[model samples]
Target: MNRTAQPAGTPVRSVPSKFRGPFVRWPRIADATLALAMFVAVTSLEEGPGDSLVVRPVVDLPPAVLLLFAAAGAALYWRRHKPLAVLSVALAAWAPMLGSSYANVGGIVIVALYSAGRHTQDRRWGPLGVVAAVGAVTLDGLLLSLPAGEIGFGCLVMLGAWYMGRRLRLRSERAAQLRQEQAAEAQRIAAEERTHIARELHDVVAHRVSMMTVQAGAARMVAAEDPQGALEAMTAVEEAGRQALDELRHLLGVLRPKAERDGLGPQPGLTDLPRLVAQVREAGLDVSLTDDIRAPLPARVELSVYRIVQEALTNVLKHSGPHTRTEVRLGHDQCGPGISIEVLDDGQGAALQSVSGTARTTGMGGHGIVGMRERALLLGGTLDAGPRPGGGFRLTAHLPVQPVLGEPA
Candidate 1:
């Protein structure tokens, strides 16, 4: 049986629906047993002579007194549902035995008081029930000429039982609140982890797949006229496919449980940019790179920079075609203590016109750009991607050099 977690302060049902058969009947059976016990205790007593209290067999009790005791005990069956009302009825029915020599039917009173304190929804009822019970017991004691200390002790005992029930209720509420907080925190962390994994998958697969697609098309176009060039294009396609598979394997290894993962390769960093530029050139794009970074960067910043540049160049290939001119520049930010990156491409291809026309109609970038922006924001940095003033697309990103605390440096 599965049960969803309930929010804090939500009322919990006493009996779940699945156990509604025998378990549901147990409460009534227990109440009936308690009532029978109280009735037997009260009726098994008698008075000897005038002013003398004594115990006798149950057979000597009159029918009317027995009926009253039975009624008082039976009222306990509804204590959980109507606690205050049941307490009142039990008190009234037991009034006849107040000064008699009966085994204290105070057991019935105690049960009713505890139920009222534990089950009542309204806070005032518990204390009100306690006060009423104490007042009734105190009045009976005074009329019977009982000692003051004995009366006070009786009141304290009743108060203590009610307090125990109330204390249990409070502790249950605190436990429920703690569970709710922990469940909420777990859900929040799961959502963040899912988003991070999705971003990584996109960055890993998109660029490699795009390169393979372009190389395959070029191979098909030039197969008849230039056999050697067609062979080189097919080789590029094969290499792109292999790189994609390797990256995906590394990603899956990272996703596995820590105990099961071993020998995972490190992610791409700034040093891998030259290789990336070389591959883009082989795909026939006129791409150039100029690196001027002076200081070493944290691993996270390096990965983000690599992914951002990869996504940007992939976008250029996808939207601007393979023959478009592009430049990737990396250097330290002159105005701030961080690294700056820019990818500029002349948007002169038919593919570029089609994408630009669609964007002009509906103003939004693709998910690749959105993922790049999210990475920058996560590292407390910024990214800007848009069409340049003259006739090209431009993407610029600035990332701080300091590593975030608690992260691998």
Candidate 2:
């Protein structure tokens, strides 16, 4: 399915107020302290200053004008909470502050411009901030008789702060998107793992149970007429049941939570085919195995081969005619790459008919074929199962082994 949300990232959660550090949790208090410091620093400047760095008051400010300057500095307390409103208030009082030559208060205007760009969520803030910068520069140039270079440089400084704030906002948004993508990928992987487990369970349970059913029925049919044959049939039934229980327990152990499971035992592999063939023989089916590849197969490839052969044998026992003879062949071609497997059955077309009929059955059928195909595809392989051209059923699989088995002989 196509992804509807981001993948491969974690979700960004909002930071709780309790963990925002002391200053962030009480922003108003922090702003008040900063405003008080600015007020004291401005008021304490020496009025009879010579041509020193300390900017002397150009005009002696009355109490009213002094109050306006103090008000502009205090308005910074709400810059983060109401950045647009704070900037507007600072701009309203900008002319008076410049006219009185309160250069220190210009620092407050620069700070307000930075906060407006950085914190304002509204898109309109961008053009509004530019307008505020242009208006401030024009007023200062006209009223204070400042040179063009000085006014231009001052405007550039305000714009630079605004640009930096905008850049930071974009960076934060990108990080959030990446986190979302990562989260989606994690969920997808989990779902795929679950499906793989379910397929394995089906392969383990179905083969053993089908054999048990055939053996039990044969024993019941011949019990009175042939007592010795019935005893042997019952014994085969017992063996099939035990083997099924053992394999089921092993798979269940792997599925248990890590803390609860003691450990995992060995999984079935190609070497176990002899025992598997013997078990099917107990159900009165004649089966033969042939192998030519001398090299060892990788664990995954070996497991898939074992399960494929097991499922094919189970199907033959369940649906083949009374006189069917089955043969299993395993080999690696020297001229090509990968391993090849084929299970052929010479029956009265019963196995072939079952395969075709099962394909059309909804839900219940086709799972065995689908499971085998899934295993082959996972290891870069292909599978084909259908009626043989002459008179029987054939299932074949070609699984690539170059990465695992290396060069062919």
For each candidate, the alpha-carbon lDDT, in order, equals 0.74, 0.69
RMSD vs true structure, all candidates: 22.3, 20.7
Q: Which pairs, if any, clash in model 2?
A: 6-181, 7-181, 7-182, 8-181, 8-182, 8-185, 9-179, 9-181, 9-182, 9-183
Residues forming the 10-long window of minimal summed lDDT in candidate 2: 9-18
Poorest lDDT segment (10 consecutive residues) of candidate 1: 1-10
- For model 1, residues 1-409, the per-residue Cα lDDT tens digits are 0011222332222112234553247878877777777777667754467735566677876777777778778888888788888878777765666765552567788888887777676688678878877887887788778899989998998898788877876887887777687445434444566788999999998899999999999999999999999999999999999999999988998865342367666777999988888887887788899999968889999989888887777777777778889989999988889988888887775454566434521123225554565678789887766566566777778889888998877
Candidate 2: tens digits of C-alpha lDDT, residues 1-409 = 1111222321212111125654467877887886676565565453234424454352565677678677777888887888888787777766656644454466667778777877777778765876777677767776767788878888788888777777877787887776565444434554566687889888998888898899889989999899899899889989989999899888887865342367565767877889988887877778899988778877788888988888777767656644468999999955678899888887553333554333321113225555565678778887766555455567778887755455332
Once superposed on the true structure, which residue ranges of model 1 sit more than 4 Å away at CA? 1-25, 45-54, 95-97, 100-103, 187-191, 214-233, 249-409
RMSD of candidate 2 to the truth, in angstroms, is 20.7
